[model samples]
Each structure stands twice: as structure tokens, then as C-alpha cells.
Target: MKKYSPELINKLTDKARLLRCHVVEMIARAESGHPGGSLSAADMIAALFFHKLRHDPLKPDWADRDRMLFSKGHAAPLWYAALGECGYFPKSEFARLRECGSILQGHPDMLKTPGVNMSSGSLGQGLSIANGMALAGRIDGKDYRVYVLLGDGEIQEGQIWEAAMAAGHYSLDNLCAVLDFNGLQIDGRLQDVMNPEPIPEKWRAFGWNVIEIDGHDMSQILAAYDDAGEVKGMPTIVIGKTVKGKGVSFMEHAIGFHGVAPTEEECKQALEELGCG
Candidate 1:
């Protein structure tokens, strides 16, 4: 594994915190959005946008740029924040999230959004789309890689399994996936809703290179990305055990916050806790 310097790790860590702040503020402003999953995936997303993925914010449609597909698109707040922070669009656009006629929709729209590579809102289809992108890269002689983020709950969809099977069968080494395994979904705990346990083993059985890590740990997250890149024949999945509503004292592990946006007071508290207030 390639060792990352302390300076780099701290920069990524700060970036993740900033992303969380953006997520909370955007959801609170919209008065409707998913916070739990967005917070859960913030660290991983930050790592990708800041360090792992190869893309130019100045040229959002750069043909050879690496693609990022958010399979669990309810976390649009998180995705939008990353893009804005990366200069895909003005950060001021975050205020219009979910508003009628805004480019920053409730879910990703590739045509409208500058950095989003896929138009994804329906769960369980991201991996299939990613598979196509990866395969296209291979055929076009482009070395760009595809990265997709999956929700633990979203994987319950039958289509996710089908995509998994196809990715394994094709040995898509250029494709990497990260599972935001924060345990809880909108309804409740994943185990109670529909268990997708033994996640790592299941992916391995399907011919993926599985690397499990603490999703919040910058070191492990960075290392997992490095490890995934080295795998040659099969696709790799980094199963990150993350905390829902991470960085907020009250929201962490609170299932009620899943699909609900924070009220003004709650948003104040969350921003304060994130050191953004």
C-alpha cells in the first residue's frame, strides 16, 4: 500500500468535514433531503473528489476524466457539495437545491449538473451504468476508471446483484465501488429492513476484490483506493463501515434523520458541531 503523508491526510480530513457542513446546510435550506446517508458517505466522497479520482473541474466533460457515479443518489446534497467545492459550479448554487428549475435537482441529472457523470435517482442501477462506462473505456482505449458509491440498503435491489454478476464475469479491473455501510437506511436498520450482511464475503464470492475499512478513517480510505487500483482481473469493492450522520452529535446513528432535513435549530446545532457555525 502506498503511504500517505500526514499533511495529505489532514487536508483530506478537513475536506470531508467541509463537505459535511455543506450537506447539513443544503438540506436544512431545502427543507427536504437525505442527511443520514449523505453524512455517512461524506468522508469517502471527499477522499475521491479531493484525492482518488482523476478529473478536471474546469473541464467537466473532459472525455478521459475518471467518472464518479452515485448509485445511492438520495445523497445528492453530498454530491452537489463535492462538485461545488471542486469548482464544477458556484457554491452559491447550493442555496437552490431541490428548488424548481434549479440545475441542482433532488437527484443527479448529468445534462444539468456539471460534474455528475450519470443521471441516477432510482436505486440499484448505478453499478450497471458503471459497468457500461468501464467497458466503454476499455473499448475506446481510454484508461479512465469508473467509481460508484453504493448504499447498503440499495444493494437489496435485485438489479444490483445482476450488475455485480456482470462486473465479476467481465473482470472489470478498471472499475471500483465503495459501499457506504452505515447500517441504517431511511426505514430503519438494514438488518431489520432486509439483511445484506456478510457483505465482504458475498462480494468475494462474486469475484470482487474486497477491502473492508473504517469509512471515517482517512488513512484506511486512501489505502483502500490504492489497493483497489492494484487489482488486475476483478472489480474491487471497498466496504466502508461508516456512521450515519457523522460529525453531528445528535444526528449520529439516529434513524429519524434518514430522509428528513434538519430544522433551523437542528441545522444550527449540526453546523456548530461541525465547526462551521
Candidate 2:
């Protein structure tokens, strides 16, 4: 694991805050998009795209690049924010989120967006797709890894367990799944909806190397990613405990913000809170 300097940590935290601002603001501009999960995932995605993932934004189709599948694609705002921040596209595209003729859709569309390795939002199918990619990499003798992000509620689907079983059975050491365990979903708390508690134990039972950490903590997130690189003989799942709407004070853990875009007034307030201009 790499020990990050205070300067590097500060930079990553700034990026995360910037991405969170972009997510909420862009959603506000479009007047439609998921904000809660998008904001909650900002720190982790910022760290991954800017500090960890092996890919060139200038060359999105580089054959040897690592694959990233966002299983919780409702958080398309977050994905787009990270991609834009990474230079996958111009920062100007952020304002067009969810608009007609915009590549940034309500959900990630692999064919429409660069840097999105696979389309998602149907919920639990992403792990299966990620498994296929990892298996293919092994068959083709490629060293590139596959990373997937799943929402806590999204795992309520039985298909998730099935995919987990497949990944475990194959001993896909190259597959790393990140669970954004923010507790709150669109409806209410995850336990009230469909409890997937004992999350780490469950993954371990599926033959995964489980690592639990604060999803918003840059240092822990970085360490988890590094640890994933060293694990062998099994897939790894990093369970990140986070708040529903992370940076925006009003939205944090507020279920109302799950799929509701902020109004212009709300946007101004959110930006003020995020220290964004």
C-alpha cells in the first residue's frame, strides 16, 4: 500500500469535494437525476478515477486499461463528474446532464459514454457482467482488472448472490466489487427496505476477501484499493459505510434527495454549503 503524503491527501479530498459539487449542481441544472447516492459516492469515485484506476482519459479504449462497471448506475451524475474531472470529456458536458442529445444520461449508457466500461441501472446484473470481463481477461492473458460499484439496496436482488457465487467459484482474484453501504435508499433505511446486513460476513462466506472501511475516508479507500491488488485466489469486496448525501448538509441521509434534483434555490444553497462558486 502506498503511503500518501499530506499534500496528496489534500488534493484527493479537494477533488472529492469538487466532484460532489459537480454532482449536485449538474443534477440541479438538468432538474432531474439522482443526487443522494451520487454525492455519497463522490469521495470514493474521485479517489479511484484520479488516484487509482489505470486508464488514460485521452485513450478511453486502450486495450490494456482496467475495466470499471458501475452497478449502481442511478448515480450517473457521479460517474459523469468523475469522468469529466479526469478529462474523459470536456468539463462543459457536465451542464448538459440528462438533457436531450447529451451523452450524460439518467443512467450510464456504455455505448453513449466514454470511460464507462459497461451500462447498468437495472440493478443486480453488474456483478455478472464484471465476472464475465474478469474471466475474459484471464482467457486473453490480460493483466487488467475489473472493478464494480454496487449500491447497498441494489444487492437485494437475488441475481447479485448468484453472480457472487459465480465469481467466487471461478476464484476471480482480478475482480473487485465495492459496496456503497450508505444505509438509506430512495424509500427509507436499507433495513426497512430489504436488509443486507452482516454484509462483510456474507461476502466472506462467498469466498471473497472482505475489507470494510469508511467509504468517504480517502486514506482507507486508497488502502483498500491497494489491498485488492495484492489479494489472490478470490474476489474482493470493499464495503464502504457512508452517508446517503455526503457533502451537502441538507441532503445527507435525506431520502427525499435520492432521485430528486435540487431546484435552483436549493442548488444555490447546496453550492454555498459545498463552498463551490
Candidate 3:
């Protein structure tokens, strides 16, 4: 977790922007899928997949590699985008998203997706799987880490806390959790739907080292990642305050955009805005 050179940070940011563009394009083409949450998590996923996670695209089953569970499985577009961009699959597969026989579904399926560590999209179950992975890594004496992404709304699931308690009890310091705190969920504002306030304090109380930062700031995000790696005795939580539907003016902060796909014209505009059309 050493500091990333400014050049490396810039490269990560650029990759994140492309990740966002890919999410938009995939969703627009499929005419279905979650875009807001996916867009919000672009930088975080890019940082982990492209820079932090010790994963091999060629050997998806590398035993000692880090494990990443996307608990908010509706963000499959983003995950698939990253994996495709990472060379796990051909880029052409992105256009077939959600289509019959396509590996990229509305939610993640580990059995089908080469790089997906756990089948997710159940909303509250990913943390448990991540906990198991971390515990297994510890038992096997492996240095691999476990990373999970949770939605702001997904935190309302009581199981998240249950898993949090378990991680604390086991002192799984190798487990790192990232919350895409975009503040908006499918129905409306998360505060109105279900609030997860004092989020960092809650994690701290659960025996976690919390690092809160702007999720889109590559520099701060990378630094926070290094900070998470340095902690001992407990898990680390990163409350990444991000903009829902980031990089697209119309979709930013709009709850309606959560599960809606962009129109052809909108996609063009969005891609143009991201400079990746």
C-alpha cells in the first residue's frame, strides 16, 4: 500500500472515467440495468481492480489473489466493465449484456463470470461471503485480502451489521469494505428511504478503522486504501461520498436514474461528456 506516484493516480482516474463510460454504454445498449450506483462506484472499483487488488485476468482462479465481492450486484454493468477492461473477457461481450446466454446478467453470477468471486445481488449476503473468504485466507496462511462494495441503501439490511459483528469478533483486518455513499437509491433519496447516518462512527463502534473521503478523488481514494492496509486487529471501512450517476449532468443525484437505462441520444451525450464516445 505504498503511495502511488502522481502519474499512477492520474492513470487510475483516467481508467475510472472510462469505466463510467463503459457502464453507461452497456446499460444504454441493453435498455436495462443500474447506472447511478454503478457510476458512483466507478472510481472505487477502478482503483481496486486496476491498481490495488492482486488479481490476474488471465488466471481467474489464482489461489493467492485478492477477492472482491460486489454486494450490490445490480452494479454488474460496472463490474463487467472493469473485468472486460481488465481483459477477463472480450470487449464485444459488453454489447450482449443481459441478453440471453450472455455472461453479464443484471446481477452477478460467479459460476458464469470468470472474475466474479461471489454470486451477488441479493442485497445483504455479500458481506457474509467476504467474511468467509477472509477467514479462509487466514486459515490457509495466505496474504490475499477480501474487498466488498456495499450500497448506501444496502446498509439497511440487518445482515450487514451481523456480518460486521462477525468480522470484528474475528479481527479480520485483511477485510476492507467500501460503501458507495451516493445518498440516492432506487426509490428516492436514501435518507428518505432509509438513512445510514453516522456511518463511519457506526463502523468504528463495530471495531473497524473507518476512513471517509470523496470516493471520486483518486488521490484520496488511493491514500485511504493504503491506510486501510496499514490497520491491524479489525476490519477497515471506507465511506466514499460519491455522486450518483457521476460524470453525466442529467443523471447526477437523480434517483430515477438508478435502474433506468439511457436513451440513444442520452447515451451519446453522456459518452461525449465523458470523452469516451
Candidate 4:
């Protein structure tokens, strides 16, 4: 594992802030989008695109490059920002979010969006897709890793468990499922909606190596990715305990922001709080 120096952590933190800003502003501009989940995933997304993922922004379809599937697809704004910031396309395209003819649609489309390996928004299905990709990679002897970011609530779908079981059965070590365990969903608290408690034990039971960490912590996030890479003979599932609508005073842990866009004033305040004022 590489050393996570204070400078590296600080850089990732700044990237997260920029990512958060993009998510917040884009959703605010759209006036009809999900802010909570996107904000919560900002740090992880930044770390993946800017550091962890072995992707080429210039060569979106380069063979042997790693793949990322947004299993929690409604959080498209976040991925759009990351892709843009990472140079898959210009970050300027973010202004066209949800536009009728914009490349940045409400949900990610691999055909429309460069660098998106799989078109996903349907919960529980992304992991299965990841498993398939991982299997294909194995068959081709490609060393590229497949990462699937799943929402905690999305795991409530039976397909997620089915995929999990398959990944474990095949010992798909190249497959890593990262859960955005923010503890809240569109309706309300995740526990109140449907508890996926004892999460670590459940994954271990299914033959996965679970690595729990503070999702917003840059150092921990990087360390977890390092650990995920070292895992062999079994898949890795990182349960990132995050806060829904993180970094925003009003939105943090607030279920209302789950699928609601922030107002212009709210966005201004949010950016100010994020130190981009």
C-alpha cells in the first residue's frame, strides 16, 4: 500500500469538496434531482476517479482499463461530475444536466456518456453486471478490476443478494462492491425503511471480505481501496458508513434531500460551508 501522507489526504479532501460543489450546483440548477445520495458519495467518487481507478480519461474504451458501474444510478450527477473532472469530457457539460438533448442525462447511459462501462440505475442489478464483467475479464485474462457502488437501500432488492452469492461462489476477487451505507433513503432512515444491519457479518457469511470505514474520511477511503486490491480468492465489499447529504448543514442526514434539489440560496450556503465561498 502507498503511504497516505497528510498532503495526499488534503488533496483528496479538496477534490471531494469540488466534487460536492459540482453535485450540489448541478442538482440545484436542475431543480429536480437527488442531492442527498450524490453528496454522500462525493468523497468516494473523487477518490475513485482521481486516485484509485485505473481508467484513462482520454481513452474511454481502452482495453484493460478498470470499470466502474454506478449501481445506484440516480446519483448520476455525482458520476457526471467525476467523469467531467477526470477529463472523460469537459466539466462544462455539467451545466446541461437533465437537459432534453444533453449528454449528461438524468441517469448515466454508457452510450451517451463516455467512460461509463455499464448503463445502470436499477438497484440490485449492477452487482450482477459487475460479476458478469469480472467473469468476462477473468475469461479473457484481463487484470482490470470491476467496481460496483451500491446504495444501502438498493441492497433490499433480492437481485443484489443473488449477485453477491454468485460473486462469492465464483471467488471473483476482481469484483468489489462498495455500499454507500448512509443510513437514510428517500423515504427516511434506512433502518426505519429496511435495516441491513449486521452488514459486515452478512457479507462475510456470503464469502466476501468486508472492509468497513468512514466513507468521508479520505485516508480511510484510500486505505480501504488498497486493502480491496490485496484481496484474493474472494470478492471485497466496502461498507462506507456515510451521511446522506454530507457537507451541507441543512441537508446532512436529512431525508428530504434524498431526491430533492436544493434552492439557489441553499446551494450558495452549501458552497460557502464547503469552504468554496
Candidate 5:
């Protein structure tokens, strides 16, 4: 668990805000891509990639680096923004997102992207990979940790529970999973679709150490992440409460914004709201 100085916290927060804007503009430029969930998860990803996770941009496969898997891979924009802005690649390449032959695809592919730990698109599978990595770390006596981000709606998949059970039973304490609890999925509200509430209790019942916090608050998000580092004998789950399309006025909590790109005007409004030009 690390205590970030005020300066570092502010730097990470600034990076997060920029990442949020990048997400919106990238989606708007592509005229396609998931924005709601990606925007919602930006702060947490920023906190991880900038301050919490231990990885080298130049050495993407560094043996001792912490691992992060995006379970809800539709939000690749946010992840790509973090990677590029944090110096994994030239930020200019971001404009080429989703283009033919571009490494930045609709979802993360470890083979293509320099910093992505794995190729992910299917729901409910990232945690399983995270668990495997944690187990391998244990067997090889490596100090690396594994983290995975899961969507609130994606939790309805039966495979998630199976992976949860396996992670708990194995006591993969080196593993941490975060739920992007924006409360909305692609179709509609999660409760209206399939409720994943009682989320913390459910994880605890499956033998994980659970905590809930505001996903957008840098302090709270950092605290939750640091706490995850201290849990020694159990997997940890941080249920991050967030609003979909958080920075844009019309998009917040709007299910229609889930997979849709914003208009040019909407992009201007969103960037303005984010305090950008």
C-alpha cells in the first residue's frame, strides 16, 4: 500500500480527466465504440495505470510488473488512452483507433497492443485469466499482482461466478478485481436487465474481501486500491460506484450512450465540460 503525495494525486487526477476526454473524442472520431462504460471507468484505470500498477511502458512484458486485464473489453478506448497518455505509445496513434491494421482495436489484444496484458472481449473470462496469473505468481514465487476490471452487467454471466469461486478457493490474495458498477449495461439498466446488487455481499459469500467506494474520487479509489495490496490470504473485490458517461451532460446514466458515439457538437460540449477546449 502506497501513500501518494498530494502532488502525485493531483497529477493522476489531471491524467484521468484527460483520459476521459480522450475516450469521448476517440469514440466520436471513430463514429462508433462504447463510451458510457469507458468514461465511467476512466478514473479507476487512471489511478491504476498511473499510480498503483507497477509496469514499464518500454518493457511491456517485464516479469515483475503488475498485471491488469479488462474484463469488459468494450471500453478499450479508456484503456488505450491510459496506455498512450502514460507513454506506452505515441498519443498521435490514438486518432488511428479502430482503423484497419491499427493495433488499437475495438477490444484489447495483448498481441497487438504494447501494454495490454491479455486479449479480451468476452464477458466473464478476465477474472479467470487473472486467477491463472495469480496462481502462476504463487507457483513461481513471483511478486507480481494481477488485477481485472469487470462490468456490473457482465456480472450476470454464469462464468463470472465460477471464476469468483475458483479465485476465492485458491486464496489468490495477489489477485484483485474491480467492478465498474455504473448500473447500466448496453441493453438498459442492470436491475431492469438482471440485478447484480448485493454485489459486495455476494463476493464476500464467495470468500473474497469486499469493499465499495466512489469510483470517481481519486482519494477513495486510491484507498481501495491500496487496501487490496494488504490483503494477504484472500482475493479482494472493489465495487466502484460510478455514473455512465460521467463527464458529459446528456450522457450520464443514459443507456443510449452505452455503445453510441457522440456527435461533433456533443464532443465539443463534452470536452468543454471536461475543462478542455
Candidate 6:
């Protein structure tokens, strides 16, 4: 694995914290949004947008730019925060999240958003979309890679398995997916709701190169991305084990926060816990 310097790790760590703060504030402002999954996936998103993705914010539609898709699109707040922080759009747009005409919708909308590669909300479709993109890049002779973020809960959809089979069959080495494997979903814990355990083994059986890591660890997250790039014959899936609603004291692993936005008091407390109060 490629070693990352402490300075780079620290910078990405701080960026993840800031992104978490943004997720809380944006959801609170909207009065409704998914926070648990967003928080769970924040660190990975931070590593991708800041350290790994190769797209120009100024040229959101650059032909040869790398593509990042959010399969679990309810985590739009986290995606918006990353895009805004990376200069894809004005950070001021965060406050208007989920508003009637805001570009920052409850789920990603490629038509409205600048950096979004896919308009995704319904579960189990992102991998298929990513497959098409990866194949297109190959046909067009572009070197850009495609990355998709999948929720552990979302994988319960049978469509995900179909996409997995297809990706394995096609040998999509240019595609890499990160599973935000936080245990809790909106209904309850994944095991209680519908277990998708043995996740790594399942992906490996499907011909994917699996790399498991602590989702919140900056070093491991960066290292996983590096390792994915080295796999030549199949796609890679990093199953990042993470806690739902990370960073905030009250929200950590709290299923109640899955689809509910924090109130003023809760938001204040969450910001304080994140050191942004």
C-alpha cells in the first residue's frame, strides 16, 4: 500500500470534520434529511473529493474528468458539502438545501447540480450507471476511472446484486466502489431490518477486489483507494466499516437520526461535538 504523509492525513481529517459540520448544518437548515448515512460516509467522501478525484470544479463537465456517483443518494447533504468545498458551486447554496428550487435537492439531480454525474435516489441503480460510464471511457479511450458510493442498506435491493454480477462478468477494472457499511439504516439496524453480512466475502465471490477498512480512518481510506487502482483485472470494492451518525455525541450509531434532521438545540450540540460550535 502507498504510504500517506501525516500532513496529508491531517488535512483530509480536518476536511472530513468540516464536511460533517456541513452535513449537520445543511440538514438542520432544511428541516429534513438523512444524517446518519451522510455522516458515516463523510470521511470517504472527503478523501475522494479532496485527495483522489480528478475533476476540475471549474469545468464540471470536462470530458476526460473522473466520475463519482452516489448510489445512496439520500446522503445528498454530504455530496453537496464536498462539491461546494471543492468550488463546484458557491458554498452559500448550502443554506438553501431542499428548498423549493434549490440545486441541492434531497437526492442528487445531475440536471440541477454542477458536479453530479448521475441523478440517483432510487436504490440499486448507481452501479449500473457506473458500469455504463466505465465502459464508455474504455470505448472512448479515456483513462478516467469511475467511483461510486453504496450504502449497506441499499445493497439489500436485488438490483445491486444484478449489477454486481454484470460488473464482475465484464471485468470493469476501471471502476471502484466504496460501501459505506454503517450498520444502521432508517428502519433500524441492518441485521434486524435485513442482514447483508459477510459483505466482503460476497463481493470477493463476485470477482471484485475487496479491501475492508475503518471508514473513518484517513490513512486506511487513502490506502484503499491506492490499492484499488493497482488491481488490473476486476473492479474493487472497499467495504468501509463505519458508525452511523459519526462525530456527533448524541447521534453516533443512533438510528433515529437516519432520516430526521436535527432541531436547533440538537444541531448546536452536534456542532459543539464536532468542534465547530
The sequence of per-residue lDDT tens digits that candidate 3 reaches over residues 142-249 is 999999999989989999999999999999999999999999877788778878897888888888889999999898899888899989999998999999999999
Instruction: State the local distance difference test value for candidate 1.
Output: 0.95
Off by over 4 Å in 1: none
Return whichever of 4 and 5 wins on lDDT.
5
Ranking by lDDT: 1, 6, 3, 5, 2, 4
Candidate 2, which segments miss by more than 4 Å at Cα? none
lDDT of 2 at 276: 91
**At residue 32, what lDDT does model 2 achieve?**
88
Indicate the residue-level lDDT of 3 in model 4: 72
lDDT of 5 by residue, 13-64 (tens): 8988899989999989989999999989988999999889999999988999
RMSD of 5: 1.4
For each candidate in turn, the TM-score is 0.99, 0.98, 0.98, 0.97, 0.97, 0.99
Model 5 clash pairs? none
Q: Model 1, range 1-277, lDDT digits (tens) per residue?
A: 5689999999999999999999999999999999999999999999999998999999999999999999999998999999999999999999999999999999999999999999999999999999999999999999999999999999999999999999999999999999999999878999999999889988999999999999999999999998998899999999999999999988999999899999999999999999994
Clash count, candidate 2: 0
The lDDT of each candidate is: 0.95, 0.91, 0.92, 0.90, 0.91, 0.94
TM match of model 6 to true structure: 0.99
Writing each residue's lDDT as its tens digit, candidate 4 over 244-274 gives 9999999997999999998899989998998
- Model 6, 128-186: lDDT tens digits are 99999999998999999999999999999999999998899999999999999999988
Superior candidate under TM-score, 1 versus 3 = 1
